[model samples]
Target: MENQVFESSEERTFQYQSSLPSLPVPALDESLKKYLDAVKPFLNHKEYQRTEDIVKKFEHGIGKVLHHKLLERAKVKKNWLEEWWLNVAYLDARIPTQIYYNFGGPGPYLEHYWPPKEGTQIERGCIAIWHTLKYWELIRTEKVIVHRYGNMPLDMSQFRMIFCTCKIPGIPRDSLSNYFRTESEGECPSHLIVLCRGRVFAFDAVHEGHILSPPEIFRQLAYIQKRCHNEPDGPGLAALTSGERTQWAEIREYLTNLDPKNLSLLEKIQSSLFVISLDDSSPNGTPEDYTPITKLSLTGDPTIRWGDKSYNCIIFSNGTFGSNCDTFVADLSPCKRLLGQDLTLI
Candidate 1:
């Protein structure tokens, strides 16, 4: 077997640099004012003052750093600061103005906070905000808006919103609480709208029939790890344990002999392999239900051959559907060799 290689620091830097495009002066429009008004109430809410202050402070510091970097990049040209202002205006028009925190339950309970329920498209606003914040340096802003809404079925008593000295719109009056429903799936149409440079964008807490969050993904990962431990002769394991033997002991022994870093690689490969098999056997032929599986492989150098024909392997990732024959056909190549057979026999 050949050793797997990782990219070098210079290679990684080059890749990162290649992905970024040259900064362009984006247009500012009246829609930005509308977006600001839409998100004002949440930003100015008393509950979120502290968080808002902190974020503003961070943004200010980051903006200063970016200004210096950009100035140097442009050879200290006059009016270079104007470029930064344009970037900031562009971002302000797109990003949200508040961040909502969950306030449900007695002790330490927090729910998923989405956007406002009415008068705006929440998903679009959220994505715009995300993009602005992510590219803040390139698109500078003194203050950024982040609309926060509590998760459904969860109480909003502890919910908090953070913002600067911005006023929220009152005309399209609506509460963040009223937008989302407690349904198990589908988009909430009445969610808050995000206006960016006069263009409207929307976002929904519901994605692919479920809500998105970091904790949810972490829980799923833990479940998969536990299942892997309990099942003796599991997909990757070649043996089983009895009453006198503990599975943990076998795992420990295996770890001792293998490189620690390879463990992650092995897990990734094993998880992907499992998804491929599971998808192939599914009655509905869809992998959306398998959220824990991240990647799948259908064909590779490791081919399985039967008689005169060779079958290629298939691969997939989470959020991917096996029914998409176009993706499979486009990604995979035909296998020309056979497994458990002599190459000359073909």
Candidate 2:
């Protein structure tokens, strides 16, 4: 018989897609199962399904809520998982344990969120504006002071310090180690010192500091919340405490309309100070050999450090830092002269 090509009907027309394999459901603990059973009427099978199926369902539901424009914009052309991989990489560098929160004041009262046991001491870079001004004397004396405020403080003193203990890579060794190992000023690590109210200060393990003033930090936080639409309680719950909610709401509303350009200016200054090490060396004499310790975004800000001096270099969307790259270049150009060398503009 002559050789002949053959096609099946199945190949010509697509059949209904096969259902994905049913994921195994873990056996719930007795207490959890009982509780789930009690609430079965309200949640139906969706709440008591296999974890994999539940995750898929949740993803599908979220897809429905996303705006079509946003979905289109977020879609990856290639290597779609790159963002997830990057997120994983970032999370891996974070400290596994939580730090104790101590509100600054006469009483070293611990906050509700303080971990039961101190895990590894993580370095939180830089001192806040308020800490520099309000607690400068105390920080200088004690080397460590607990912040009464929660999270980052709001203040204007953009002076920031880099320390050795943070979970993040590339930070210098602990200040205590530098202090004990070397008395020579040359051996001393470049310190991020805040000079406020005629006082100089640094944060120790027990104390904390921020890069912004209280009002400024608050404004930034408000701006972030407004942009992200975050809420302390789950979304759509308006029954929470009115006083506190109203206060934050007002701040958030005000900041929503405010220009972010000025805020970016302060962040740039502080970020720059964080990466520079005064103790490091520059070919010109002033330390110009500083490498950026933090990964900076072209759209956001870049933290650059040389020796003991660091600064946040802001890059505009156009790949220019600020009005013009030359503007910043001109400002930093003088530092080369401080290195005892005359250099021509690039």
Candidate 3:
């Protein structure tokens, strides 16, 4: 597929959002049949027969009531699976999300013009962050090209969660928070969060109505790196995010109640554009051998990566890159495509 940005006023990217089809609810009997078929291989003949009878009973009883309610839900909601999927598959899951749910990959630029280079971490990171911010601008202006299948448009709603979005944990469930706004909608937060040496810092991505250039970003990153090198390590509060869901939720509530300034700091990190993880591990690997980088992307430095953020760009010490992305909010392929195209600019 090719991408072509829309410059016309009438041809906006999300123009077809209302016309897209709503999520369909499967028939209860058909769903039960498939479930029985899936379980048959694991059960003996008698067990299978007993399971089939149970399934048949349920299909005609309370299952019918639940399916009717689901159908009623589909009539009112465009995508009935949207919130339910987030809550059930992600938020309510008690496992460590960073290792189990998040997606990670080695940067494609290593095989291209930008290979691993020593002492280039801050420099390359600034360039990548600048391009990422540009992509954010495209989304804000609704100028990014929309994906389509034949004549039908696919969902573009995930793009809004690509930046300034986070998942807030609850006692037994979690909820997603998105602070992104299109240019037509109004002003949105333009700050960025930097994670280095177990510390967190925030700065504005836009100043004087213009996004910061790579050089300006470079200076900011340099200062952060310098301070990290000179000072003692921070408390590394980001590490708490890697724990079990309910436990983290309780801790988060306690943390917010500890001090009001702490709550503001947490919100600032939650609503920023995305996270930039300046890591110390330099996993030397090539495009053909990505095992080392991939391992680190998923398992390295939990203190430097926010496990719940929608996107985390991990810049290694040797200037190679890896991405740790939350798969619940959106697919990683779109961001990869955008970053791949932007890498060509450098």
Could you tell me every candidate's TM-score relative to the true structure?
Answer: 0.21, 0.20, 0.88
The list of candidate 2 runs beyond 4 A from truth reads: 1-46, 49-140, 143-188, 191-273, 276-298, 301-346
User: What digit string (tens of lDDT, one per residue) describes model 3 on residues 1-346?
Assistant: 4345555465677888888889999888889989988998999999999999999888889888999999999999998888887778888888878789999878745557777888999989999889899889989989887877776678888889999998887877877888999989898988888888888877787877789899888888887888889988887888888888888999888988987777877888889899989999998878688988899989999989998899998999989999888877650342231121100000
lDDT of 1 at 62: 71
What TM-score does candidate 1 reach?
Answer: 0.21
Candidate 1 Cα deviation (angstroms), residue 125 = 40
Q: Which candidate number would show the highest lDDT if scored against the true structure?
A: 3
Which candidate ranks first by TM-score, i.e. highest? 3
lDDT of 2 by residue, 248-318 (tens): 23443343347565233222222221221111111111123212211121111111111112222221111
Q: Local distance difference test, per candidate?
A: 0.24, 0.24, 0.83
**Model 3 poorest 10 in a row by lDDT:** 337-346
Answer with 1 or 3, whichever has the higher TM-score: 3
In terms of lDDT, model 2 sits at 0.24
What lDDT score is found at residue 15 in candidate 2?
19
State the displacement of the C-alpha of residue 195, model 2, in Å, after optimal TM-score superposition.
21
Ranking by TM-score: 3, 1, 2
